[model samples]
Target: MSTLTRARRKLRAHPVAADAALAAGVLACMVAGSFAEPHGPEGIDWGVRTPDVLSLVLMTLAAAALAFRRRAPRTVLAVASGASVVESVTGDPRAPVAMCAVIALYTVAATTDRPTTWRIGLLTTTVLTGASMAAGPLPWYAQENLAIFAWTGIGATAGDAVRSRRAFVQAIRERAERAERTREEEARRRVAEERLRIARDLHDVVAHHIALVNVQAGVAAHVMDKRPDQAKEALAHVREASRSALGELRATVGLLRQSGDPEAPTEPAPGLDRLDELAGTFRSAGLPVEVARGDEGAGLPAAVDLAAYRIVQEALTNVRKHAGADARAEVSVVRVGPRIEITVLDDGAGQDQDHAPGGGHGLLGMRERVTALGGTLTTGPRYGGGFRVHAILPVTTRTSGARDGRP
Candidate 1:
């Protein structure tokens, strides 16, 4: 960067040293000005005109006070103004002691509010000008008295402008920081929602297939020696169930892969169209599941279709695990007015499994899926025995079209 830019940055880094240097520079200028004649030959100024010892002492004191202007601005202004008044009243030819007061007034104006700057700046200007005009050898109309008024006013005006610019810059910086924080919070919220969605998908896939595999594996172990053919068939079902589970798992986890990875499987997500296939898998595992539908050929929104399929899959999986072996499940899909309804009823000898150990998250996941699609789900014990799950999903093209619009 430029040399001037580097020097300013260094000064800002060491405020005390910077202020000390300012005080020294002001002292040098005032000391040099003290000797210059205010008026010379032909009504102009020249040569050196030395001030009395008291004026010199006051000038020195005023410049020194400027070193701490930033630390105590009001106190420094008071000291500097007092020194200028003393020089104005007592000196034969007034020294440029008021230069130091002007600097102090600028510091006060820059640090304090506008009202205080006005009060202090006016008081200093009045006192110094009045003193020089009334008590000095020069008359009230002397150019020196007028110069004092002008310089002090310039100091206050310049200082106030600098303060306003600093405030404006600070406000802009705070607004930018607040916008950055809001963006970060929005990103985090989206990430959390995506994680929950993936988690629910994984749960549904694993729970359904694993339960079937467990059942088929148990059958193979029980009949391995007594019925070789039946054991082979059971083992084949286990292998098929496991392969399907892996395929679904790979598809689900593929969503989390980086862009550089191999392409994911193009197989379409399962829906009600696969309901019979899903039921067949349960039948092979010894849970008799029957599906009935009155919706006919009506197309569903992609989200509603997926939700309905998963609800059925999860409900049947629960029935196979918790319902008695003799229990049978009936799943029905019906178009009722403006909504599609799905009901799964099981005659299994199982109690309310919602509060049972290891059964909590299934119902909650179902509820979340239904709610996310702006649908409603109810699950509880049936009138006589077993469990029931009923869900009502909107069938409007508008709802489905909205879901289609999302990534």
Candidate 2:
């Protein structure tokens, strides 16, 4: 920083030192003004007469009181005002001691409220002006008496204005800071929602396609020599599933791409309308999947549709991966009075069927999607020999998105 700026900061940091310097300046001005005679024979003349000992003593006391103006403004004002009143009554020329009182009044006004400023300011002006008019060597209507009134009023007015400006700037700074905090919170919320949506998309895509690829690759390996044609068909299914997995992964990850990068696929998100195709993929992979729909002609919101599709896909993927070689899966969708209910069950007696699948994200992803849509899910071991997954989704979501209210 520059020299002047550094000096101002130091002065503000040590206000009493700054006030002492101000007191010294006021003392110099008072001593100098006491020597001047405005009504001299040749206009205003300097060094016409020196102040009396009593005037000098009062001037010194008034200036010294100003050194503590900021520490105790009202007390300093009272001291300075008393000294100026004594000088106005006792000194012949009234050595400009009221200047210190004016400075003290300004300090009082700046540090206090408007009502206090007005009360203290008016009282100081009246006492000093009345003392000079009624008891001084000068006449009651002299300009010196009126000047005390004008100067004190100016000090009070200027100090109040400065206080008002300081308050205004502080208020604006607080408002901007509050707005900045709100923007940061909103941005973080949006980021969290987007992350959840991407996670759900990735889980659904990988769980469904990887399960199919794993099944097909195992079949191709088991029958490679005995049934070459069947093995080749299984390899072809593996290729298709792999390709589908890549496409879905690209679409989900593309959400994080920068603006200048290649655009992601514009294919609409899967919904219950694609239930037959979803089931066919599992059926071809050696699992029997039966899908029944009771909401054939019902229209569903986009978020609800996507969430429903993901729930079914995850549930079936779990069944295929954990529900042994002879597993049979069934899915049902029904619309009932402002809600869409989905149920997926499997008659698989696989050992892993009783436990969580894929580190538990499958079930958790399904639950997150359902909860985001103001829905409920129930998943547990079946009564006899299988596992059951059921979810109820709102036809119209409370929020605006499928995964946590982000479009």
Candidate 3:
């Protein structure tokens, strides 16, 4: 960097040393000004008369006090003003000790509030100007007395302006930083939500088709030698289930492809219209699912349709996996006013239906889907025998404004 820039950075880093250097500079100026005579035959004359020993001593004390201006501004101003007053009363031509007081006043104003700056600035101006006017050998109306008042006023005003500019810049910096943090937080939240949506889709597809494949494979193994024809049919069913699983998995994973990748599947998501086909797959897997529709062909929102379809799919998968072989599940979809209701009931009487083979996230996933679309789900064991899954969804999805329109 440039030499001037490096010096400024060092001054800011070591303020005590910078203050001592400033005091030396101010002392030099004061000693030089002491011998100058403004009223000489020439416009002004330097080294016309030397200052007394007492005036030199007072000027030294005032400059020394200024070295501590930043640490104790009020105390420095008091000391500098007192020295200036002593020089004003006794010296024939007063030394410029009051220059130190002006610098001290500026420091105080820049570090303090406006009210405190005004009070201290006015007090320093009155004391120094009044001392020069009332007791100096020069007349009360001399220009030197008035000059002290004008310089002190300028110093205070300039300092207050600097403080205001610094504060404004600081406020703008803080606001920009807060905005950046908020944007990062929002992006993270969207990533988390998208991950959850993809997880649910994968689980529903894998669970439904894999369960069928497992059942058909077992049947094929059991009948391999005794019943060759039945075994062949079972193997065929396994191939069909695996094929379906692959198609669904491909479609689900396609969603993660970037814009530059090959185009993804555009097929509409499954809904109530696919109920018959869904039942046929389960029937072939040895679970009898009976579907009933009571709503006279009314349209449903895309989110609601997908949620309804998944809920039925998950509930039936659970029945086939946990319920006894003979268990029969009944699924019903009915539209009532502004809402559509779906119910799945199974009379399974199987082992503890509360827990599935590998820990059950099926119920939890279903609940999250329903809740996202502002719907409600109730699932538990029926009183007499099996399990029941009931869900009520608004025909027109009423998602919270915060949702990212995942469906």
Candidate 4:
């Protein structure tokens, strides 16, 4: 940086030193100006003409008071004004002793509010001008009295302008900082939402297929010795379930890969269009799931379709895991007015094992999905002897794309 720029930064960093330097500069200027002759051989001469000892003393005291202007601006202004009044009355040769008072008034104006600046500025101008006119050796129309009025007014105006510019710059800086913080908070919120979405997708994919695999594996083991042929078919079903699970898992994990990696699977997300396939897998596991639809061929939004399919899938998985071996599940999809309703009922023998560990999380995830689309889901044990899951989803949901399905 330039030398001037570095010096300015240093002065700003050390305010007390900056103030002391200002006081010394002002004192030097006042002392030099004090010797200029008020009237000499030439018209308005500028030659040195020393004032009385008292005038010199008052000028020194006024300049010294400016050193602490920022610490006590009002007090410094008062001291400087008092010294100028004394010099105006006593000095035979008036020596610009009021210059220090002008500097003091500027300091007070910059530090105080505008109302206070006006009050002090007017008071200083009136008292100094009145004293110089009434009691000094010069007449009322003397140029020195006019100079005091002009200088004090300039000081107040310049100082007030400086204060306004500083306040404006500070406000701009605070606004920029607030905007940066808001952007950071918004970014964090979006990342958290994405993480939750990935987690829900993983759970739905794993839980549905894993439950079927568990069932088929059990069946294969039970009939392995007595009926080898039946055992072979059950093992085949287990293999198919596992393969489907792996495919879905790969698709889900593919979403996490970097953009430069291999392309993600082109297969579409599972929706109500895959209802038959989902039901067939459960039937293969010997759950005897029956599906009935009355959606009237109405197109559903992408989010609603996906959410409806996952809800049914998770409900059926719960049935297979908790319901007794003789359980029979019935799934229904219906359209009523502007809403699509889904219900899954099971005629399983009621058992305490229905409420399994981590079971609440599955229901909670389902509820989150439905609620996001402004829908509702209700799942609980039926009055007689089984579990029931009922969901009401809006047919005309606000989605980013149109999904081909009758939810």
Candidate 5:
């Protein structure tokens, strides 16, 4: 930082020292004013001789001490006030001794709490004004004595005002800074959530399609020469897998774009209505797929349907990968009054079902998708002997306004 800025910062950090310097300057001016010839007021020319060197020296010392008034406010006030009283009672009362005392009072008021300032300030003003009037052989209402009273009051009032304004400004700045931090933190949290949802979706989509490709490639390799036609069909399955992978990959990646970007894709997401096409893909793979429908199809929102389809698809893919070839899986969809229920079951001995329910990514992704849309999912071994994936999705979607449009 520049030298000027550094200096200002240092002074602000030590406001007491700054106030003391100001008080010292004002005291110096008052001392100079005291040197002016005292015009005999009201023709009372009985001034024997002006205050000698001794009284002047005392006034100067007291004024000089005012420079540290804010640093040690009580000490400065006590010392300056005592010096003023001594000047009034012992030395010449005409000297400018009260100047340092007035400055010290103001500093005390500004640095300390207001109640303390008021009590101390009022006592100091009364003492200075009363001593000046009574010790000078003048009436209590003399102009000089009243001027001390007014100056003391002004000093206390002005100091309090300065302190209050500084406090108010500091409070406003703190509140604004806190609000800015909250906004930044909230934005970061939203970004992190979006990234997680996108990652989950990618995991589910890729795992399903990639697993299928792996299966087809293995079959094709095993039958390349003896079953040339079967190899061609396996290659076709590979093509289908690659295409589906591309489409789902696009859907997952599309979430990365800014919501308002012109390049962003505008497309309808998969929903429950598309479950038929999904089932057909499984049927083509020789898995006997059965589907059930409900009359209130229009009630299901797009997001709910998509989550439902993903749940069923993920479950079926796991069955194909893990279940024995003879296993016949039953996939059922039912709609109750307020919910759509999905269940995937296999008659095979599903001791492995203990682990199938662990989505690692697929089941996890399914749960996140379902809950994001205010739904619930459960997966475990069915009673008597098979693996089961069941999910309950609400007809009314949860609009959480999160990134990736999870809701």
Candidate 6:
């Protein structure tokens, strides 16, 4: 990396001592320059003054502070401003003594804000210039006083320009950082939304089909001792339900796996063609299930067919579970205009209905599934004393299109 980066990372590699030695050498030169001449004004003391040694010591201290000025600007400025005031009031030539003050002013302007620099710079210049003219052995309009004014102003102005540039760069960095954060947040939100959509699909498909399987298994075990033909039919229903569940589950899960990793297993989803076999499953379980079709042999979108089959299957299962043992259920599949309406009705008081149509997540899953296909679902107690579940699923499944909802 760069030298500054290496030095910042490793504290021991700093050049503080080397810089201090260099500043000391420069200070020595300035001290020597002050003693060489005193051309402060035309008629002022042109040679060395009486208090030259003390003035040299003060100027030397101010110049020494320059070594640490970059590290601690405020401290360096304080020392340099003090030194300038002393020299303007005591030294023959304000001379090289004001050099340290100029460096410190520049450091302050570059590091601090304009308002703070203005306040401190004006104060330093005012104190030093006024002190040199009012207390020094020179006239008020001496060249030394004019030189003090010019040098101090240069230090403050140059430092302020450097400060402005640094502030501008920092602002640009902050704006880029903010935009990056917003992009990351948007990406995270999209990921979460996709995951939820996948999960809802899994829950609806698995819960509906698996419940049918469980109900079929129970029926086979219960009637196996008495009715051989009915028990065999119940077992057949169990096989159909399990096989259907496994197929849908595999296809739904495959959509999520990475394409390059490995091939995803899939099985075709059941549609309206399976409706007769599904209705037979409930009839074989000792519950009377009657189906009447009014679709006129029309084919629906695969998603609509699947949603309609599940809605009817779940409703019939609830009838067998909650309705009285004597209850008879009706299943109707009808095409009404642009929608396919499939409804299940049981003539048993649902209060005794251990498996009402809207219990648990079955009905909720049905509603979500139908709605996703751009349809409507309504389930509740029938007006008199039964339960009814009606779902209107669209022939053209809207969710199948990418434009249905964009991530």
- Candidate with the larger TM-score of 2 and 3: 3
- Residue 20's lDDT within candidate 1 is 91
Please rank every candidate by TM-score, starting with the best: 4, 3, 1, 2, 5, 6
Q: Tell me the TM-score of model 2.
A: 0.85
Comparison by TM-score, 3 against 5, better one: 3
59, model 1: CA deviation in Å? Answer: 0.9
- Global CA lDDT of candidate 4, please? 0.86
Per-prediction TM-score, please?
0.87, 0.85, 0.89, 0.90, 0.83, 0.64
Which residues of candidate 5, in runs, are more than 4 Å off?
Answer: 1-24, 37-50, 133-136, 258-262, 348-359, 398-407
Instruction: Please list the residue runs of candidate 2 whose C-alpha ends up more than 4 Å from where it truly belongs after superposition.
Output: 1-17, 38-45, 115-119, 122-143, 350-358, 398-407
Residue 156, model 6: Cα distance from true site in angstroms:
3.9
TM-score of 6: 0.64
Q: Is candidate 5 or candidate 6 better by TM-score?
A: 5
Instruction: Give the per-residue lDDT of model 4 (tens digit) for 1-407.
Output: 99999999999999889988987887788777777775777755554566678877887898789889899988998998898888888866356778878888888888888898999889988998889889888888988888888998998888888888888899999999999999999999989988898899889989999898888899999999999999999999989989999999999889889999999887788889999999999999999999999985778877888999999999998888888889999999999998999999998875533367646767878988989888998888888898989999987765533333434
Clashing pairs in 2: none
Instruction: Kindly list the per-residue Cα lDDT of model 3 for residues 1-407, writing each as its tens digit.
Output: 99999999999999999999999999999899888888899877998888889988988999999899989998999999898888888877558888988999899899998999999889888888888999888888989889988998988898888888888898999999999999999999999999999999999999999999999999999999999999999999999999988988888898999999999988778988898899999999999989999975898777888899999999999999888899999999999998899999999987544576664688888999999888899988899999999999887664522254646
lDDT of 6 by residue, 1-407 (tens): 99987866564455577547657876876766665445556644534544367776886788788889778988988887787777766656544677787778888899889999999899878887888889877898987788888888988999899899889999989989999998999999999867766776677566656666777787788889999788888788778877867877888888888969577775556676887887776676567888899996887767787778778877887777677678899999999887899989999864633353555666666777777677888888888888899898777665444444533
Can you list the residue pairs that collide in candidate 5? 359-363
Compute the lDDT of residue 247 as modeled in candidate 2: 87
Measured on C-alpha atoms, candidate 1 has an lDDT of: 0.89
Where does candidate 6 have its weakest 10-residue lDDT segment?
Answer: 398-407
Q: Which whole-number lDDT from 0 to 100 does residue 298 have in model 3? A: 91
Q: What is the lDDT of residue 198 in candidate 6?
A: 76
